[model samples]
Target: MTKKKKIKISELPNFDIVDYLKTDKDIAQYLTVVLEDGDPALFVAAIGDIARAKGMSEISKKSGVTRESLYRALKVEARPRFETVTKVIHALGMKLSVHA
Candidate 1:
């Protein structure tokens, strides 16, 4: 029998926080949690977590947006315009809000 490979947390790549953020499922879940908790900071924190996971520098380059702009848009007090939100979400491969 082959020896089982032991994986270490440190050895493993960081979780794909950006991929999670980019998915509709994740956004839905986050929205649900936010609605329940009523904390915009948590939402901003989540976005920041994803940005860090995906390498903010790379994301900024690919998204045609500055890292500082992204951070500002995701900040707790930020009132990002719909267009700005759309651009960020699209850049991140996420979908927008829809009414059913």
Candidate 2:
């Protein structure tokens, strides 16, 4: 009988969410789905994902918010101020829109 070989799960290549959010259309569709769900915290968290995908330092520089602050604000359950949220959204090349 031949011996079977097994690989540990951790030994497998890691999956990075940021890699999946590489394009503008991909990010837009992802956020749109998250927005339709209507969870404020989730929306902010998605922003965090986008920030990470685009590069946190760049997002921080563009948003005019420090790296630490950006992480805190985008964290789960964090209630960031409107200005901060807007800055983050714009930093990710996105803007809030309303439809009548």
Candidate 3:
């Protein structure tokens, strides 16, 4: 009989979407996937992911949203105001576009 190998949690490779979203092309691809998911949480989560990718503190500063508020607003359970969302999006150098 052959022996099976076991892998520990610590032995697993770290995977972070933010790390993959370093370029405009990468961010666009990620956003395309998020939009395809058609889940609001995913959109909010995408923003959160981008925020983290660009440094939450810097995003907060650029958005005029406190770090605490940014964290709370992007939470899956939180329904933050549209204006606040816009600010964060703009801070991340992104904007919403409409399609027919």
Displacement of the residue 78 alpha carbon in candidate 2, Å = 0.9
What TM-score number comes out for model 1? 0.52
Off by over 4 Å in 2: 1-15
Residue lDDT tens for model 3, 1-100? 9999999999999988888888888888898899899988878878888899889999999999999999999977778898999999999999899999
Tens digits of per-residue lDDT for model 1, 1-100: 8999999989988764455665567766765676468675666555555555557777677677789988887766776665665566566666646477
CA lDDT, candidate 3, residue 61: 96
Positional deviation of residue 36's Cα in model 3 after best superposition, in angstroms: 0.8
TM-score rank, highest first?
3, 2, 1
Select the stronger candidate by lDDT from 1 and 3: 3
Better of 1 and 2 by TM-score: 2
TM-score (C-alpha, index-matched) for candidate 2 = 0.83
Total clashing pairs in model 3? 0
The global Cα lDDT (0 to 1) of model 2 is 0.91
lDDT for each of the candidates?
A: 0.66, 0.91, 0.90
Give the clashing pairs for model 2.
none
TM-scores for all predictions: 0.52, 0.83, 0.86
Q: Which stretches of candidate 1 lie over 4 Å from their true place?
A: 1-28, 35-45, 97-99
